[model samples]
Target chain A: MRTILFLLQKEFIQIFRNKTMLPIIFIMPLVQMLVLVFAANLEMKNIKMKLVDFDNTATSQEIVSKFKASPFYNIIGYSYSVEEAQNSLIDNSADLVMVIPPNLEQDILNGQSPKVQLLIDAINGMTAGLINSYSSMIMLDVNKDIAIELMKFSANQQLKQISIKQRFWYNSGLNYKHYMVPGIIVILVTIIGMFLTALNIVSEKEFGTIEQINVTPIRKYQFILGKLIPFLLVGLFDFALGLFIGKLLFGVPIRGSLFLLFSFAFLYLVLVLGIGLLLSIISDTQQQVMFLTFFITLVFVLMSGLFTPIETMPLWAQRVNIINPFAYFMKVNRMILLKGSGFFDLIREFLYIGIYGIISIVVAIRLYRKTS
Target chain B: MKALEVSHIYKTYNDITALKDVSFNVAEGELFGLIGPDGAGKTSLIRIIITLLLADSGEIHLLGKDVVKEYKYLRSRIGYMPGRFSLYSDLTVLENLNFFATVFGTSIEANYNLIKNIYSQIEMFKDRKAGDLSGGMKQKLGLSCALIHKPEVLFLDEPTTGVDAVSRKEFWEMLQELKQKGITIIVSTPYMDEAEMCDRVALLQKGEIMSIDTPQNIINEFSEELIEIKTPDLYEVKEKLRLEFGKNSAFMFGQSIHFSTSSKSKSKELLNEFFEENNFNIESVNIIEPNIEDCFIKLMTKDS
Candidate 1:
């Protein structure tokens, strides 16, 4: 225990000695928080639109007003003909377009819905899809207003209906920063906390310290545990800083128990740090550790389902994601923060992550014995 | 009980045999030396005794405890300063010393007297990071860290290889002080001069022991008269001797050369005549006593 503390203190001092690491440790997360909260938004808004009006009537002008008045579209330009509208689209001047033919008012007055053309550019496929859907929403509102006007003229009791209401669960405002910042925090902790310790140890060995320590009375477990535990603390410190930034800068709500999130984050850091210890034991050089850890972290984060939902992955990829600890941690973070889940909700993930930590410490200790 | 004992210690890495049927023992309080050139298996043998490595077929006992089975107990009684400087570079001298002491379940104050003599020289820079220290200071700190627990056996592997001359002298003087306290020491060195300082020395080559005895006794085994010859054309003389007497007659020593032979009387007169004929000045020529280097070369050549 004393040896572990001594080593831990030494490691921390070394970390703080590198003046460049201080700013990165403290300020980088807050900077990321600020930039990402405002810049990382995935919400679809402020759409640019063009119009092609062939009808040139009052009805066409009223429909165009419906689109412009709605906050979704800012009418950039209007084309007198379809050729001009095509040129507008080719020049990327607008993301959406409205076409009103000459017979639009006559068709609707005759009790037949007007077959107006709605052109949407699907170049940025997902965003284009949202813009298309939003424009159709405006058209629906126009139809409802016309229906209400006509219903006043003719009394139809069957057409008197009440409105259906909706309430967004959990995140009522659909805040993007609330979700993205926490996930980014988890990823930063993984990269900075775990890999640096392993690379440092490997560098010492390459520089010849392991051989020196081998002859000393330092137990294999003590040596490795000393290297790992301090880095684990650093990771937790970073985690706390990230959480603080998430709350202070982005106003990301922590609906779940903070203690629960802290517990899982600590356990998950143990798992990551254990893997770092194992990497240090197996690798003989810093370059090797850095290269191998880079590959492992890349694979872990890609399938972690942080940016994308795990439900959308194919079956085989989902199976691969099950073995990834980052994937489990990502789920734990979202469930705990966004959904206000209790311990029982993360019981299975917590157990597997705990098991992984135990196995890694055991395997790393075994490797130290044989390889030393 | 013996401080160290080994039997049939054979170690092979892939296909190369590092140690073959190697066996030796060091009595308690003896400063035994393993003297040889590079790659003579001295390191492999030290590593086994320190429990960093295991021999394929052998039993090693340190202080009457099995090295492999009782590694933890044996480690507590051993202090090892490896050939390379392996102290924590980012840490200050104090931190490294305290850390190593803590690892052995002891404190620096408890073992301060043991390392005090050596540590005092480098004490001025206790706060300086070890990475910035000079080579001599590093070796001192490494020794201090190793001795912080006051182990019974002190194992130094080529501790003076890259050190300056004065520091080497100071290091040996400190070893003498440790020896006065009845600590058993086993130091390996390739420097032949260091062999005479030990209680007993073994000349090893290619994982095989060539000679094991005191320095005087090993030198007594040299069966040739060594003469250092300097001629106008030294290369011509060496070639002439190699051409005439084949391999056994000539061996290079520094700028001049040593001719090792049992019949130097017959060759001495011929050499003078050749020198007089060649108009080379006979500044100095005399039969010299055999040092460890000469003794080692003779042992190696006699066996081959």
Candidate 2:
């Protein structure tokens, strides 16, 4: 235990003495959090729309006015021809186009339903889908107003209709930043925990200091635990800072118990740092460790459902994520912060990560040999 | 009991043999040297004995403990300074020293007297980072760190390989002081002249031990008469002499040529007559004593 304390003292001195690495540890996470949360947004607004009205009648004009009043649509201009409206879409100036046919009022007065054609740019499938839904909702509102007016004129007192209402439960406003900040915090914690520990031991190998330590009386478990504790503290500190930034800058809610969140974060960091130690043991150079960690963390972060929902991914990808610790952390982070999930709700993730941490550390220590 | 004992040690990397059937013993309190050039298996032998590397097939007993089986207990009883500068360069000198002392589960105050002779030289620069120190100072710090634990045996691999001439001499003097304290020291060096400082040395070459004995005894064992000849055209004269006396007989030593002959009498006269026939400008010729390097070359040539 005294030997481990000495090792920790040495490691901390080396870590803090590195002037270049200080900023990378403390400031890079803040910059990433402030930038990625806002930049990675998928919410659609101000969709550029083009209106084509063949019937220059009052009803068609009223419909065009209704679209103009909506906040989601930005009408660039009116086109007299359908082909001209399509040219706007092809030129990338318009995201959506609505065509009101001629005799649209005559068909309505004759109790015949008319068709309104919508020409939407389907290049980006998600944005095109949003535009289609928004335009359809506006058209439905116009139909309702027309139906009520016609019912009053015909003295039909009994008209039956089924109306559906939606209320988003957790994220009422559907703010993308709220959903992204917690996930980005997972990434921040992972980078600090994994990359630093991975590079630390490999640098010692490159410098030949590890050989000196290996020849000492220190046991393998003592040496490995000595390396683990300092970085674990640093990882937790980075996690706290990330949480503070998430709450301050993005107004990300922390509805769950802070104690439970931190306890789980501690476990998650151990798993990450354990893997880092394992990589360092197998690699001889800092460059090799860096490449290996980078490749692995890249795969984990992408499959982590940070940018895309894991449920919507292919079945094989979802299966692969069962072993991805980042995915577990990302899900738990969102659950605790946004959904206020309790400890019992995240019991499975806790058990898997804890088991993974213990196994990786054991394997790392077992694979580390004092002799070469 | 012997401080270190090895019998028929062998080690190989892939298809290349590093140490082949090598064996040596160091008595307690003896200052021993493994003298050889680079790639001569000096480091390999030292590493195997120190428990930092495994031998292919051999038995090594350090302080009567099996090196492979009792490595964990033996580690605390031995100190090693590898060929490279292995101290933490980013750490201050005192911090590096203190850290190693703590790692060995001892305090500097407890072992302060052991490293005082060496550590006091750089005591004023204790606050300076090790990486910012000179090469000689870095080596001194490494020695101090190794000695901080007061191990029974100390292994130094090429400690003076890159040090300055003055620092190299000082390093040897320090080793002598440590030897007086009765700690067995096994140091490896490529410098043949450094062998004279050791109580005993094993001249190693191509993964084999050429000879093992005291420096004086090894020098006295040279049975052939050696003649040194100086000429203006040294290379030309050397090549001519090689053709006449065979390749292993004549070699360039410094600015002159050393020619060895098994013919005891009138060898110098024969060499003078040969130089005269070749129209060589010979300054002079005289019988000279053989040094360790000469003995090594003779053994190497004889073996090949």
Candidate 3:
């Protein structure tokens, strides 16, 4: 235990004494969080609309006004001809084009259905789908209003209607930042924990100091524990700092117990830092460690369900995510912050992540040879 | 029991054979030197013996325990200074020293007597970063760190390779002091002069030990008479001598040419007549006692 303390003391001194590492460890994560949270947004808004009204009728005007009132669309212009609307779509002035037939009011007055055409640019599939859904919703509203007026004067009226209301749970507004903040915080902690510890022991190898340590009487477990504890502490510290900044700058709330979040963070950091140590032990230089760590972090972050939903991914990818510690942490972060989940809700993740930590630590110790 | 022993140690890296059936031993409290040039298996042998490397085939016993099976037991009793300066450069001298000491389950005060003579020289600047120190200071710090555990056996591999001449001399003096304390030291160096400081020396080259004996004994055993010849055109004369005698008979030695032959008088007479005939101005021609370096060259040439 005393040996571990001495090693920890030396490691902390070296980390704190390095002038370049100070800003990298403490300030870079917060900067990344601030920029990525606001930049990486998936919400679609400000869709440009071009109107082609062949019917000089009240129903046509009402449909156009409904689209104009909604925040999702911008009415670029009212086209006199279908060619003008097609020209607007071609010249990039509009993303959506709506055409109402000449007899829209006549058809409604005669108790017949009138067809509407909505032309959407399908180049970006996601935005196109959203635009189509929004346009259909507005057209449905117009048809319901027209039908209700017709039914008001009928004496043999036996009409029944069912209305469905949607209430989004947890995130009532469906704020993207609220979901993104926790996930980004998970990435920040992983970067600081894995990258630093991966480079730490390898830098000692480059400097030739490891030889002096390797020849000593220290046991391999003691040495590994000594290396692991310092970086674990540093990783946890960075995680807490990120949480504080998330709360302060983005208004990200921790709906669950702070103790549960932190305890899981500590375990997750062990799993992360253990993998770093294993990389350090296997790699011969700092450059190799950097490249390998970057490659793995790229894969891990993309598939960890940080930016996209895991349920939407293919079945094989979800199976691969079972081994990713980052995925577990991302889930736990969202569950605790967004769902107000307790430790019981996260017990399966906790056990799996804890088992991974033990396995990684054991493999790292096995690979780290005192003699080579 | 012998302090250390190696019986038929062999090590290879890829296709290159680093040590070829090498064997040697050092008695308790004796200072032994492994003298060779770079790439001569000195570092390979030292690493194998220290348990930092595994030999392909060998048996090594250190302090009456097998180096492979009992490495953990021997780790605390042996100290090693690698070929390069291996101290933590980011750490202050005092911090590095304390760190090594603490890892060995002791304190600096416990072994201060062992490293005092060497450590005190850099004590004033103990707060300075080790990387900022000069070469000599780094050497001293490496030595101090190696000795901080107060081990019975010290293995120093090329400790004075990059040190200045004055520092090298001081380092040897410190080793002599260490020897007086009854600590067995095994040191390797590329410099031949360092061989004289050790009680016994092994002349190694190309993964083979050409000779192992006291430095003076090896020097005296150099059978051929050594003659130093200098002239205005030294290179031309060396060429002519190489043509006259075999190529191995003559070599350049620090501004003079040294020639070795069994019939010294006959060769000297013939060389004088040749220089006169060729109109080569001769500065001096005299026979001097062979040094350890001269013996090393002679043995290597004879072996090949």
Q: Which candidate gets the maximum lDDT versus the true structure?
A: 2
lDDT of 1 by residue, A200-302 (tens): 7887788787776776667778788778777777888888888888888778778899899989988898889889888887888888888889999998888
lDDT of 3 at A335: 90
**Model 1 chain A poorest 10 in a row by lDDT:** A152-161
Q: How are the candidates ranked when ordered by DockQ, highest leading? A: 2, 3, 1
Q: What C-alpha root-mean-square deviation, in Å, does candidate 1 show against the real structure?
A: 3.3
Candidate 1 lDDT by residue in tens digits, B1-304: 8898888899999999998888888988888999888999999989888998988998988999998888878877899888988888888999888878877889999989988899999999999999999999999998898899898999999999998889988888999999998899999998888888888998878998878899888888876677888755677777777676667677777777677666645667766776677666546666778787788777777767
Worst 10 residues of 3 chain A by lDDT: A151-160
**Cα lDDT tens digits for candidate 3, B1-304:** 6998888988889999998888888999999999998999999898888889999998999999999999999999999999888888889999999999999999999999999999999999899999999999999999999999999999999999988999999999999999999999999999998899999998888887888899989988988778899887789889888887878888898899999876656677777887888888789998788898888888888855
Q: Per candidate, chain B TM-score?
A: 0.94, 0.98, 0.97
For residues A186-211, could you state the per-residue lDDT of candidate 3 as single tens digits?
Answer: 99999998998899889989988888
Q: Given the true complex, what DockQ would model 1 score?
A: 0.52
lDDT of each: 0.83, 0.92, 0.90
Ranking by TM-score: 2, 3, 1
Report clash pairs, candidate 2.
none
What RMSD does model 2 have?
A: 2.3
Model 2 has a clash total of: 0
